[model samples]
Target: MKKLLQTIILLFFFSLTSTVSFAQGYKIIGKAIGFADSTKLYLADVTDGSFKPIDSTYIVAGDFRFEGKLKHKVVQTYIHTKNFADRVSLWLENTTVHFSAEKGKFKQALIEGSQTQNLWTELNKAIKSSKDEKEQYVQFIKKNPDSIISAYLLSLFSTSWGNKTIRDLYGNLTPENKTTSYGKNIETYLALSKDIQIGGSFVDISQPDTSGIIRKLSDLKGKVILLDFWGSWCGPCREANPKLVTIYNEFKSKGFEIFGVGAETSKKQWVTALKKDGLQWVNVSDMKGDKNEAALMYNVGQYPTNFLIDKDGVIIARDISIENLRTKLKDML
Candidate 1:
């Protein structure tokens, strides 16, 4: 009996020491099971846009331990096992969580104790609602604008049809809670939204296209430029491209030019579409989807969006239809 008691004491001391040493940044202690092969453990520090190696152990015994300091305040924990699948877990400060992964994908939480659970619960409820997407979304924001869940949802739908609706919902928020973290995040997001109002025109700070090299947008100061936003997948844009082609051909000698901003996710698609569509104009894009950074800056919610900038690089019209665009071009040229 005395020997058994001594062994238990020793085991307790060892476990205590291990916990203290590994609990610095974030610690993931769990077992991974592989159906077809052995499982592997990986400890990555979610910083530098890459994961940093810390400690790794095999799951042959169905046990693993990972420990490391996160360079950033927020970091993600990933478990990549061979032939089994991959699992991802998120850890934040001042929280304790216990969960398991199923098929290396969805997390099955059998136990958890954290403040973030509230945010999760709220998001789950918001997503479960069966009302119309737009109206349900508007109602969610109206009720929980002061909660992180609402803030995140609002940010997600800000640039969609929810853009205007979400804005109006926030306006109805109580003034007291408007300065909360959720409120401020929404405010900052809305403030950064692109302004499409006429006058105080937008200038092209980018370099010009002369010398077959880098050029600034300011170089085309005296020429009226038709800034066309288009994509290869857009049938409307394709139909509009010919009209633009006609306009460019007619006005090229009259101090008018065409510049295209493509909204294509794939580089190959953008290039192929450009060639196939016979677009002989200067084009640029970040190669992101409709929610691209540039598109967000320009407040473009729909495709075939554009800005008719005067020679001085001032926005004269936005979302100008083909007929209106033709009339605007005639007046500008």
Candidate 2:
């Protein structure tokens, strides 16, 4: 009887350990109502605007499941099916979640489970009804500082808000949240943003132009520079180019120069637009489109973003109107 009791105790402890280990990761159970048999389902991990497939499974009787651990406790993940044609994006946490969808309609899937998911649902609903979505995000962070979802939302708004506003919001986050992946991203973003803020010294950028010649922002330091971030495909940028051409002609001899940075993916399109618009300026681009190195460095959230830099290389104004640019140039010249 003594030996049997010892054996039972050991088994009980082993079972408890197994259960705890399984609970440490995420468990996602999914059901697709009209999915075909042997269909492939892929789980993709998203980071820094890129998606990578991490796991895959085949559907059996319209049911599928994924079980794995995440490096970060909370992360953005996507589920793709139908040969990667259909996709559903969701936030994953260390908890079991249930997802359901219909054939060829994965994006409209229903997701359930986890407190963070519930909060995300509520936040989306609020965003749909609120006129000021940024304020709603701020309010949500204020209410749930410990939530990783709040950290993600904060990161999204980092480019729009001022340094002090972002820093204050970061301060409101819990100590644990401050160490999460998105939390660290926010910290890094704020650090970079401080350098490019209005009144701060301009950050230098170097990229190959259409002629394959390297152009550096510092090369035009002796002149008052209009660092224009624009693209051929951007309607507003195209519309504003003619006015900029006029401004450039007027100011070219007054120690003022326009350094146009095209946020274009296609080099052919960029060159064509430049010729068509009759823009005679120092235009340069790395040709990575919106992900252009200069655009990212400047934190340009919109096209036609212009930074008026003084001859001394200090940023004097940002996104100024055509009239404002003219007035400022007249006053300075």
Writing each residue's lDDT as its tens digit, candidate 2 over 4-123 gives 999999999999999997669898999988877988889888755567887898889989999988777678888997467788888887789999998778877889986777788889
- Report lDDT (Cα) of residue 185, candidate 2: 72
True-structure lDDT of candidate 2: 0.85
Candidate 1: which pairs clash?
Answer: 206-217, 207-215, 207-216, 208-215, 208-216
lDDT of each: 0.61, 0.85
Q: After superposition, how far is residue 325 of candidate 1 from its true place, in Å?
A: 1.9
In candidate 2, which residue ranges exceed 4 Å CA deviation? Answer: 1-15, 18-24, 33-39, 58-61, 81-85, 103-107, 195-216, 230-299, 310-317, 320-333
Deviation (Å) of 203 in candidate 1:
3.8
TM-score of candidate 1 on Cα atoms, chains taken together: 0.51
TM-score of each: 0.51, 0.69
